[model samples]
Target chain A: MTNCAKPSANCAKRLVNSMSVSNDAKPGVNSYSLRDIDAVLSAFEEGRLTPAQAFSLFREMGPQFEAPPGQGQDAESSNASRLREALNELDSLIGLHSVKRLVREILAFVQIQKKRARQQLATEHLVLHMIFKGNPGTGKTTVARIMGKIFRETGVLERGHLIEVERADLVGEYIGHTAQKTREQIRKALGGILFIDEAYSLARGGEKDFGKEAIDTLVKSMEDYRDRFILILAGYSEEMNYFIQTNPGIRSRFPIHIDFPDYLPDELIQIAELMLKKREYKLDPWARNHLYTILTKHASNLDHNAGNARFVRNIIERAIRRQAVRLVDKENPTREELMLIRREDIGEGL
Target chain B: MRRCIVLGKPNAGKTLFVLHFAEFLHAKEVTIKFQEPVAAPRKGTGVDPEARTGSAACSLDPVSGSDPGAHGRNPGAGFGPSTSEHFKTYKIQDAVRDLTGPRPHTTRCLQSVVLELPAGKGKKTVELIDTSGLTDGIHQDAEIRRAMSQTLSSVRAAHIILHIIDASKAGKKGAVEAMGDVDYQVAAFAQMRGGYCILANKIDLPGARDGVKKIRDEFPGHIVIPISALYKEGFKEVKAFVLREL
Candidate 1:
């Protein structure tokens, strides 16, 4: 028999009061069921949910399920939730607020649609297709995740999820094979978002290319499941534009294009700091200045470099690794001892 | 069988055109085969479809023969009993393996039905060869340039050439300039010396008419047809045009 906790008015009142307190105490915390969390994780695995959306949803649910004494239910659930949230938020460990804002807007739209559905109003304004055109590491995946959250919050999606995939995943080795593979990916991303990174790679061939089969399948599915799924095609701006125009079906379905601009040097530094903080470490003032100078030099040298947060994070990691190796004792260095990443740590001419 | 090749520039709906054409043939209950083959297995343990079926034979293979019309019906006549027997158990896996193979040689051996209406006659079977788009500028890679050259060499023998233009982009300043440049190159090609039909694709877009008009104005004597390749619009008109010209 189902666990029948009577719909007691007192219990409902207590629930409401607890919810209010949770909301007031940690506005960032999300309140979601275990099923919802599973859906979000599945979406991420399937490339339908972005990391940001998963993070935002988990954040909202963090404080809601407090441990009840002896039952041990709340503690286990809370611990699992915190672990998932930490991993999801790790993507944002390198801050790019512009990308975050874009993700929030997507989530907001999902929430609005959910409200309409509850009121029995038709959802006419929901965006089912989006295009992310930018250089690599511009946080396109991050934005896709946040959009998933917005969808969950708005009630457009039962469980907001984001799945990230690539051309190789969708395009098969053969003509008929590509269609089936592409279909499977779509099935995996059902009722959620599917992000196709380097989407233009699907168009990088001639008449007999298997990528064409994937494109044909994607177009048909997009039309058939317009309400249930959203597709985000991301790649280098110029190539992506050409890729869309290559197929008439793609051009019609994906009308909205979101451009992700490369980060400036200052933005890169801020991202570097965020990465350091995530590890519970702080940079010495001089070390920070030295790191910033190295980033500025490298950013100017590389043509395809987007001044991406990932690049800064990677450089910081390298510096930390160098510092660790040079330390008096390589193993078991305390946080304070490792806190000051030096100029020498970054290495010469890097 | 007679081979008809489809050739054009990048982003000119070449792949979409071929896919839709294949679908159209499939709807008519015609057997179609693609030319390109998939790469070999990583560990080399299992047999791919291309190895099973004799269909992966090169277009110029002397043993397989060039006449697909006769060989398509009687597979044994060209490639011998052993090769023909293997093809009997042909699956879609083989078709995909063939389609995905990286052939440095730019030969494509596509087979599809050609619905032709000559006066009061019904549709007939005709093989279609869909080749890679021609890149006009100097290729940085010598291998790619050679492959493209080989593909272009085969186009001279094609019964028809489908020159697709982006109708929506035709009226823009850049597109207008590009159209002029493309027209000169295409018109100058000895392979397309006889003449070619211009397919003004993407007519579903707002500025398609203006683009088509610009092309028509620029090349008054050339045969130009407007179409929305995505929506399958003007496909009948295109089919009729191909039938008459071929």
Candidate 2:
């Protein structure tokens, strides 16, 4: 009944609907007994009552007779679960324990600061200029992209796109050219994450280098646009620490720092399994053994590509291609044969 | 200014409704702006119905021509982008005798009258447009086909739509006022916009009540107001609706 009360004119329709339901049970459902319906019809006939009033009379007859439009996803559900979708993607990564913990802490801090502002309390500014200390193929770029989605869902960025740039993309060849190039990239990164890979290389040149001009432009724009964008400087741990020590202006502005650690041999195998599961491909026992050997051999090497998930991803993708080639001459491959990556398909080199 | 258009089948008394509505708003003199018809622009959407508002307002005797199609059918060449318009002002009685008739195509061009309604502290201008009647299939006359095309374009752009349905003849299947695919198309198109109402016209005649009920059943979730356009009945509710939207 209360549901019908919400829409006043719709009452007439609701009452008419319920009156039919009562015709089976109540013996008084005859013409003379329904004086209320007669009144509504007469008012409707004379054009004396507006559409809303007539609908309300319909509603006044009855409302709570049936289940209202059952078990569907209503439009007004909270956005928290939608935001959790991005976080779930973040959590589902095979490794990066420390990175996930730091992300949760940063989100908690930002949420609390916003709630403080809502209550008229003194709130901290959300300066999430981050420094990512990691090596190549260590999931730094991937994490940056996920962070962009999370920040956009949290209302920190209008467009959660990631724009990747290196020192060459930021620094220019001539005088006054570096700032122009850097500002253009910054313009593209506004309302998104600006990921500068191998950022320590920006300080590799002498004091009079164009890289200095690029860094200065970045620091100035960081303050000018303040919360309009997020910037993440990524490099090796030692080099990034040294670079931060040399540039005093950038140290205080970058309040959050996260480290993308290399995966262990076991975690690397899990990542390969997750990737294969996502592609709907599977490894036979022998091929799985071959993958374990390849991963364990590279586990202690500590090279630029050692203990990296990207290396495993490339191997899986190449093996899939090799499997496709192996099956092309056959009359028709079954679904299992088509999806299987065999022992002969695995190769260390491209 | 937001446009509120009136559309229906021919001889449905759409012209009478517009004039009586103007008089209902206390309009003493009605200045009509008519855009001369061009070759029927390739049918409908995204095409601009070039509604040429009058630049020169020439004075005419209160009663100028008794012929309904005199002002609209300017025999000028009908191509290109340049569109000419004709304007005339008339008292309510003069407009009724001249514009409204039992014939189907009395209004052959895009005719609009700008009326003001009191909003908050000032008056808000609304251009009330009367369009040529639409038919279901291929029209015999090319000029009417052009006018119908113009009506289609105007219906797409107008902010408010007042679809006039002839209640008296709605029960008769073969009559001009019978519900057709064109009426359904208008209702379907207008459902997306903000202000759209169905005025079930000619309610003073018999069989109109059943017709109104049928209209309500056919197009559920629409506001249907039964009105006798010639008698000026139920104009107050329409005015209130227009003012609320304004």
Who wins the TM-score comparison?
2
Cα lDDT for residue A339, candidate 1:
78
User: Could you give the CAPRI-style class of model 1?
Assistant: incorrect
For candidate 1, lDDT tens digit of each residue in A88-179?
Answer: 66345455555556555655565565466445568655556889888777777876786666554443554458888998899887658888
Task: Quantify all predictions' global Cα lDDT against the true fold.
Answer: 0.56, 0.72
DockQ scores of the candidates = 0.01, 0.02
RMSDs, each prediction?
29.5, 17.8
Error of 2 at A169 (Å): 1.6
Of the candidates shown, which would achieve the greatest lDDT relative to the real structure? 2
Per-residue alpha-carbon lDDT of candidate 1 for residues B1-246, written as tens digits (9 for 90 to 100): 234556554456654565465554444332344332212221212223342233444443333344456545443221101112112112233332333232322333332334333211113334455554444333343323323333343444445667777777776654322453434345434222443678888789897898999878876677788877667777777666555453
Per-residue lDDT of model 2, residues A88-147, tens digit only = 989988789999999999888878875675455787777889999976678898889988
Tell me the lDDT of model 1 at A216: 78
Please report how far candidate 2 places residue A200 from its true position, in Å: 1.2
